[model samples]
Target: MASATFPLLPSAGRRAGLILARRTEPHACRLSPRFSTTPRPPSVPPDVAGRRAFDLRDERGEDNSRAQSMGTLLSHAGLMPHRDGNEPLSPPIELATTYERPPDGNYLLEDGRGGGRVYSRTNNNTREALERAVAEMEVWNPTRRRPKRRVGEDRLSDGSTTPPMADSDTALPPPPALPVCASFSSGMAATSAVLLSLNAPVRVVLPDDIYHGIPTALHSVFRRHGVKWTAVDMTDTDGVKEALSLSVAEVEGTDGDVVLWLETPSNPLCKVTDIRALCELADQVRCGGGSDVDGGGGGSCGVNITTVVDSTWAPPPITQPLLLGADAVLHSATKYLGGHSDVLMGMVSASSATSSGRRLGAALREVQSAAGAVPSPFDAWLVLRGLRTLDVRIRRQCSNASALAEFLSSHPGAGRVHYPGLRSHPGREIAEGQMSGGLYGGMLSFEV
Candidate 1:
C-alpha cells in the first residue's frame, strides 16, 4: 500500500520544507463515509467554548462500552452528524481562507460567547475537526474503566464534595480530559515553536544518536540566539544525570532553564531511553535540588527543567509517552499520522495540569497563530483521511519489519540489525515495558 512505503529524502535539506514542496494545489474533494460502517446517533450537541466533547459514551452511559479497540476509535474519531439528521459520516473540508463577520462587527459578545467560525489562520472547521480526532486518539486512558457504582455514592468517602454525576441513577466517574493539540505547517515548525517559546536562556540536552537536523538547527539557528545544547548517551541514566547536573551548574547564577530532549529508540542506532527515569530526574531538578556531579552531597540550584519526548517513530498503538509522565509529546504527522506520504504537518500534545505546561501550550499556539505557520484546510483534511486507517497500516508495517529484522540478524553479510524486538538488542527489556500491542514499531536500521 502507498501508506506503508517510507520515502527517503536528502538529509542536508530542510525536511519539512522538502516534503511540503512536493504538494500541488489541492483539488475540490469530498469523501463519503463508506469506510465507517458502524452506526451512531444523528447529532451530538456541540460543547461550549473552551470545553472538550471527545468522550464517547453510549445511550446507557457505560464506560466499558466506549471504543476499546484502536481500529474502532480510528474509524470514528472526527465524524459528526448535522442537525438535519442526514449528515455525512465523513468530515467536510472548508476551503475558505476567511469567515463572515457578525453584523455588529464584534467577534465576542458581552458574555464572551461567539460563533465557532473565525479567521482561518487562527482556527478553521477542518483543522479543528482534525485536532479533535488526534487529541482523542492520543490521550485515551484505559484505566478509567472501573467496577459498577451504586446510586448516591458518587461523593468522596473523605467528605469532600464532587461534581454532579451525569446520570442520577448510576454514579459514574468523570471521563478523562483530552490533551491539547496544536497543528503546524510542518514538523520543524512545531519543533521550533516549542524551543523558541522558552523565555529564558536554556540548556537543551539531546541524545548523541538523534536526528541530525535537530542538532544542526540548534547549532545553526538557536545557538546564535543564546540557547545552548549538549549531546550525551541517553541510555546511560547515570551519564544523563551527570549531564543535567553540569548543565545546571554551568548556568547557575542566571535565569537559565534546562530541558531534556529525548528521542527514544533513537534514529539509526535504535537506542532506547528510559522515559520514566528521565521524568523522575526532571522532577527532582524542578524542585530546586541538583544531583552531585563528583559523588558529593546534592545542593539546591533553583533551576527549572522539563522533559519533552519526540515519539514520531512510535506513534499511537505502539507507545504513549505522556502516560509515562512526559511533559509533552511531539510527532511528524507526515511520517505516520498521515499514514501515506501526503500531508506535511506536525503536532504537539501536552496536558494543562501544571502551570509550566499551560504556559508552554499557550506560547506554542501563539507562535502558530501569529507566525502564520498553520496547515491549510485541504492538507488538514488529507491528514484526517489518513488517520482513519493508521492502525491497520502501522500493524502491517510492524509485521513486515519484524520478519525482515529476524532474517537480517541471521545473515552473514548483514553486519548488524538494529531493532528493539530482537532479543539481542540492548534496549529489548525497556522496549518490552514501554511498547504496546505486541509490536515494537515499523522503523529499523541495519549496516549492510
Candidate 2:
C-alpha cells in the first residue's frame, strides 16, 4: 500500500545497453560517472535497505492492508514488482506455452509445491495472478487470524458436529486450510470438472430453478459419469430434507456420496434458499440423522454429504457463500465478475477443512490441468481488470435494479416481479440477512 512516484527518465540519445542508477528517495537520484568498459548500475531501483525494510507494514501502518476491502485488493492486483527489478508496472501477459527449465533441470521441486513453471496448460503467471485476486476478493477477511479450537470440536460455522473417528489411535485433525480457487475456460466446464471429479455412485440434489446449463451439461457432457441427481424445490426446507433423507436411504450400505447443490435467488425465478438452515440439514444428513423413513434409526448412515453453492448471480461483492457453511462456492466469471459480456471464464473456491472438500478442490485442479479447459492469459487479465471496478459497478446495478423492481411491481401489465428487494418477495428477509451492503443484487425477472 505504499504508493511511490518515481522520476521519469529522459529518452534523448540513450544507448540500448546503458543502465541508470536508481534513487533511494523521491527526487534524490544521482548519475554514476560514465566509463567505457565498466558496467552501469541496474536501470531499476535497488531494494531499499534497513531494519524497516524487512517489516511488511503498509502505508496505513497495518500489515496486509490491501485485504481491508475488495476495492483495495483489486486496485493492487499484479502491483508487486519482480525482485529482479526489470518487470513492468502492469503485469505482462506471459503468452509462452512453456517456460525454460532452470539449470538444475528439475521441473518439480522436492516438496511438491516449489516447481518452476513447466507448461501453460498446468499453470501460468498471468492465470495465477488472477486466481490470487479472485481468492482475495471472495474471502471475508484474509488478514484476520482464526481463533484456535480444541480437538474434537466441530470446525463448521454451524454448531453441528462431525462424527468422531472410530480409531482411538487417530491423530487430532489438522487446522482447516484457507480456500483454494481454480479458473476454467467456461462456466459449464468448471461445473463439469466438479461433477466429474466426484467418485462414482454419488447422489446429487439440485434446485429445480437453477441455471439451465447445469441440466444440459448433466445430460450431454457428463452423461457417462456415474452420478444420479434429483431436482427438488429448494425453497421448501421440509421438501429438501425429505429428498435428502430418501436419497440417503437409497444409497445406504453402498458407500455412495451425497451432494446438496444450492443456488440462492435461483436463476430466472429469484427464489432464495435459507443457506444456514439448509447447511444444518446437510450436516445432519452427513452425520446420518433425518426423519427415519426406515423406522427411527438412532445413528448416522456414514454418507459423505457436501453442499455446493452456485453464487454466480450474487458474486463476492453481493454475497459470500463459503462463510455460510458451504463446502464450495462457484461463479460464472463471464457474468458479473467480468462486468462486461466479453470474457468467458468460471471459478470455484473450495474449503480446505473437510477431507471431501479438500479432495474436491484437488480433483478439480487435476481435471483443470489435465483436461486443458483453462482460461487464456489475456482472458484472465481482462477479468482481473473487470474485478477492479466490481465494487462500484455492483452498487450502481443493485440500486437501479431495486428501483426497476419497484416500478415493475406497480405496473398493471407486468406480472409478479421476481426480485429479493421487493417488499412482496418471499425471501426478502433472508436476502437482507445474507447479502452484503444491504443490497439484494442486480438480477431480476418478471413476466409481462
Candidate 3:
C-alpha cells in the first residue's frame, strides 16, 4: 500500500490473485483463507513501516476483511516499527465500540482462565500490544558499587580491631526484562503511584533545585496518604550522609519507605549527578556501616536505598541509569520519548530497586488500572512513534544547544552559561561516565 501501484508483481501469488479475480465475475468473487502477518496482533504488514497504515489496504483482497485487518494492525502494527518501513498511508485504527472476543482470543475486559478482555475499557488489543512492548523494553540492570578497602570489621575509630570487609559480588547484575510499562496521565500520576504503594513514611532525597512537579507529586500524593519525604542535595557528599543519617534515626522502629529521586542534568539547567556516586551514597545510607546491601560488597556497611533516577532527559543509547547503580530508572517520556512536545507521558524502569523492578511494575499496574493512567494505543503509538527518533533528536539538540550555549557564554548581556555539553561543566566527568550516547543534550535553557 505504501506504493500506490500494487501492479501485480511478477510473483506467482499476485498473478494468481489477479487471475482469480478475472476468472470469477467481480460480483461473484469469493474470499481467500485468512492469513496473519505477525505472531502478535501488533505486527504490521511488511509494507506498514513508515506511515500510518489504517487507510491503506490490499486493493486485490476482499475489502470486507478490512475491519478485522484494522483491528489486528491497531493492536500490533506499532510493535517492531521501522523508520524506513513502508506504509500504505492509511487512516489510523479507531474502534468506536468493543468487539466480542474469539473463543481463543483474550479481551481486555474479559476475566477468565486467562483474564481475557471483554470490553475496551477493561483491555484492548492496542493497549495489550503496547503494554507488552513497553514492558519488554523497560527492563534494565541496576549497577552496584564496590566496597572501599577496610582493614577489619572494626575501624580505627576507638582503635578497635575491624573485621575485613566481605565481597558481595564484584560483577554487576545483568539488565532485567521489562514485562509491564506504565504510561501516566501526568508526572504526578507517575510519582504518586510509586509513593503511595507503600503504606508508611517515604523519604524523597531530592536536589535543592528540583522540578516543581516532583515536590507537588510527592507532597500531594504521599502526604495525603500519610507518607513523609526528605530531600537531599547531591552537591555535597556529607550533606547526603547527614540527611540519610538523620532520616534513619527518625524512622527508628517504623520501617519508613524512603525513595530518593534524582533529576540528572538537573531540569532546565544541565547539571549532572554522578550516578555512580549517588548509588554509592544510597548503598552507604541503606547499609548501616557503608557495607554493600546491593551485593557489590557486604560488611562495608551501606543500606540498600531505593535510588530512582529520572532518565527521561536521556533514554537508551544516550544514557542508561540502571547501569550506573541506580535502583530504578524513571522517565518523563514526554520530553524525549514524546519528542514533538505534543504528547505528555511518563515511564518507570526497574533495575535493582524493587525485586528486579517487578514489584514496582506490579504495583504500577495496580495503580494504573485503579487510577486509569495507562495511555491509549494511539497515545502509546504516538509516544513510541517519536521514540524512533530519540537518538537523532538528542544528538541534534545537544549540538545546537552547545552552539547556543557558547554564543550566550560570550554574549555581552549574558552573565553565565551552564550548559553541560561545554567542557567547563563540573559534572561533565560524571556525565561521560554513565551516558551511553552523545556528549551533549537536545535541550538547554538560559537567560539574556
Top candidate, metric TM-score: 1
10 residues in a row with least lDDT, candidate 3:
62-71
Given candidate 3, what's the lDDT at residue 204? Answer: 62
Ranking by lDDT: 2, 1, 3
TM-score of candidate 3 relative to the true fold: 0.65
lDDT of 1 by residue, 295-360 (tens): 111123256565678898998778888767676778889998997787899888764543445556
> For candidate 3, lDDT tens digit of each residue in 154-187?
3332344435545434434433544356667555
Cα lDDT of model 2 by residue, 225-310, tens digit: 66678899998888898889887777778857677899987998999988867877877765655532212111233676667889
lDDT of 1 at 12: 41
User: Cα miss at 141, model 3 (Å)?
Assistant: 10
Per-candidate TM-scores read: 0.76, 0.74, 0.65
Scored against the true structure, residue 261 in model 2 reaches a CA lDDT of: 91
Model 1: how far residue 266 lies from native, Å? 0.9
Residue runs of model 3 more than 4 Å from their true location after superposition: 1-77, 80-115, 118-122, 131-175, 290-304, 352-356
Candidate 2 positional error at 220, Å: 2.8
